[model samples]
Target: MEKLYDHLITHPLIYVARDAERALGFDLPVRGYYIITSGTSAHRKLAKQFPKNIFTVEAERNLDTHELLRHPQTKKYISDLKGAGIMVFKNTAMIEKTAKENHWKLLNPPARLVNRVEEKLEQVKWLREYADYLPPHEIAPLRNIMYEKKPFILQFNHAHSGQGTMLIKDRDTLDKLASAFPDREVRKTDYIAGPVFTSNNVILGEQALMGNLSYQITGLPPFTDLPFATIGNDFSLPHRLLTSTQLSQYKKMVTNIGHKLAGYGWKGLFGLDIAVSETTGRVHLIEINARQPASAIFESKLERDNKKRNVTGITCFEAHVAALMGIYIPNASLTPLSDGAQIVQRITKKRSAVADKVTEELGKLGLNIVTYENNAHNSELLRIQSKKYLMDDHEVLNNLGEKIKNLLD
Candidate 1:
């Protein structure tokens, strides 16, 4: 373990993001690491707690991580941390240039590969060998796609949190998009009706360290309005929801997919969204998140909490950084996280009266809350995390979820 830290500390590890609170479960030593983020309550708290380690890059809420990095203050800070290793939730060509200019290492896959695998149509071709596991999907020009008057999943080349993925139910909607982008090729598939599941997997040499499978909480009213917009993840439901055979099948699928990705010289974390057919109980690969998944920090936090009680294993975040640094944990695997859940509250109303009071009450109830200010419409404004289950078998909010939802509503 000491050797691991020794190697890791050789170059400073800097986590650059839109909000500093997102680094809650990074579990890296603060002495040799830095957090660069925009001004938020959580970011302010971290600045006070670790004055020397947190740098603020104040910007408007709509600016993303890449845009935030362009701030002169952000550049000045990076200039001081020359030769540092940069880590981010996602990678971009601009970010890669930042690293090169500062003589720092970009702790992520090359932007070219990330860009290639991110395309919805390219992912289908890349994983064609495992086509049996994918939903019936085809890529064609939007104008040429035949709509059968049924709800179908339509996807563009890139998007996040279902932003570019749409459920087209009418011919008029299809025609509108077709008229807008006639040359655009879209990935169309049968809308698989079921709860979506996602996992964060780390690719090591010849192996994929599979993390816990979580029930993807998405499109729940009061949380998000977009039908497929991701809300959060329920770590407590997967094992109970999946049969023994289904569990085995999922693991095999992910392992094989990761192995295939390894042949492409890919490393570190990549996530997969799998949808199980409600009618047939069949698992279908929905999409690939070719970079670190959004849920990694929260999930890694659970592993850290388990560590305090002597639970042993390399955590997903640990494995992620190690993989990026070209370090491998021999025979490393994580203990499956059996219980816990998290949800995000998208900003629907500006400065709602309930925001402050609810965050206070929820904190009193032992729930962890991270808030963001000035966020764009429908962007995550608050995130609630709990060690207990928040949803029931039918996917409805349990008592905990209800409590949070009621307070916010």
Candidate 2:
């Protein structure tokens, strides 16, 4: 923690997120880490572990966090934000564009390096040099890719919380997707069949600290548009989550990716996508998220667990800020608890009803619900905060989906 401040003489970190707790945990003497978030649910509760840390920008349940910060109403915080030591964003092209437009002092990787990663083609191309761990993937025109003999998955390079992802089972969907979205530069690859996991990593220059691995809950409806949309992540159930060989292999892979990222000059949090094929018993590097992943909401919950047990747990975001500041915080990941744990789910529902009413209704049933007007979807995002591992249990998912869908009725 001391090392973080050592790098910057007077550069206070300005953390922007959807909730305050996501940005908390820098051991500041006087609220040095300012949290600029848009909203928190009743269940998406936030507690400032640090003393007197001021939470930001009066969150509206249905508003986007960054957009809220950029809104004319939030112009007051813009001045102080411009003066910060560094601006830490959640790693979207939108945020990068925001920084460029506002000319904020964002001390992450270059925007070009960061934006290139948002696309599947660029990520594959970057990691292609290190082909030992990466899955079999090819970058080319989708039209040419279709002529290959084997069944493959066509990707649009960039995706939003799994929106642009497709299983690509047949030609009909492939043609449909291409016709529907003709502009996206596509890549093709043989689908690696396995449970996909995200290893939250902190890359500090030439070094990459591999964080905890969490199984991604992908493609369940009501929570996502397609079956492939990542709705939640389960960090626990760690009993043999990966094989002995895989555990070591992927650690080395992340380290390799880290050293490679150093070449591009990125010292920040990233999610390394890995797929451990059940049939072949082999692990393969799938993709890379060059930003603070959506799975980071889990860290806020870990902070909650630490409070209950009276322990200090270092959150990835906290450590991420530290890493970017040239400090390596040991144990960036925390094991909170096991056995049917709370799976923090990020769900989106179309805006068909009053969002406040939906929140009120869900809250009445003791569901920690927060609704957001997603700029990507132009819909109300109903993030059911840690009710239970909805994906872990199909019954819960079914019941929850029916309940929310009933709201439309």
Candidate 3:
């Protein structure tokens, strides 16, 4: 582990973390940059890998505007980081206020853009100007059955996860549910409501960096399936939901939309959920995620390499270090971990015996463990807490799946 730290000290990297004070301990005097993250533990891990050169600003909590602006550390960190900082929060209002007051750079879409694109009705209006590329969708008025169609998806713009989304198969069911929750504001139907489509776009500024088509598997809900399968098998897919040509066209549309958004002060990452009709193959714009996608696919892709053990996690730290130093990442694809490298499951106290059992089993199969977390010694274990492995990709993943299945059984 010390060797790993020593290697990182010599390499250029970036650190992004929520707490800058706590992250400064792992500083390395190297030619790198950093961007302190605000919400997730994964970002914290990135910050821990490169300490000294990183800059971080804390997300102001639910305090009053005056109190948040006056916090000593908040004032200091924000004043220091200035344009290099990134802040994420659930409340759009607070995010807007804080960013304005402190002059911090937001890594997600601006609040105004989110508010504009969140409602299905507003999105429909925007898409109407480009009707040739979009599917027909009607915005239902408060508890009103605007469209006599089955299998429509109703979306609430401000909802997180899949909270404000509903799929209705028939008008009767829609009426029954709508009747049950009559308060229009609180109901899902009151928000930007629409039918679910197949295509989605992940945009950087106004350019579509990655575009994916959605498909339903046998066992999961239509929309929920993508997150589940993409989580572990990020490098593989059983079917093609969108062709290369369609994806290219989608990227153009996303770029146009993003350009329009830039006029509204949107200057970061955002996800646009678009729906394509199964029958007519027409696309419809759904809603936009103002922040990072909850699925964590971006981080997973960044950390997917296979050559170096635990490269995904380490590269994340390196990337953060680079971002903080105001270094421009010329190519993001080069930083991703290699394909087919199964993320070795982390060993905790509860999983110690299980990890040992699996380690012994794999050794018998002639698979040499490249990295293993030593839980016996406190300090060494803490240093290598999240252990990863380098293995024969096929054999290791299949064996890992088997091990998990056997343990569960």
lDDT against the true structure, each candidate: 0.81, 0.60, 0.40
Best by TM-score: 1
Residue pairs clashing, model 2: 11-85, 38-59, 119-157, 120-157, 219-227, 219-228
TM-score winner, 2 or 3: 2
Angstrom error at residue 318, model 1: 0.8
lDDT of 3 by residue, 147-169 (tens): 35545556543453344556566
- Model 3 residue 274 lDDT score: 56
Prediction 3 TM-score vs. true? 0.53
| Candidate number of the best lDDT | 1
State model 1's lDDT.
0.81
Distance (Å) between predicted and true CA of 94, model 2? 6.8
Model 2: number of backbone collisions: 6
Better of 1 and 2 by TM-score: 1
Can you give the TM-score per candidate against the true fold?
A: 0.93, 0.75, 0.53
Model 2, 235-324: lDDT tens digits are 553333676787788788888888888777888788888777778978887778887775565554554565467764555655677767
Tens digits of per-residue lDDT for model 1, 1-409: 4445677567677788876665554564456678888876667777887787887776555356877777788778877877777888778888888667657667788888787777887877778788778888888999998889689999998877868989999999999999999999998999999888999998976679888899999888787777788989999888778888778888888899898889898898899888888899988888788898889889999988887788888778778877877776788887568899999988564432234777899897789887776446667778889998798964688888898888876
Worst 10 residues of 2 by lDDT: 336-345
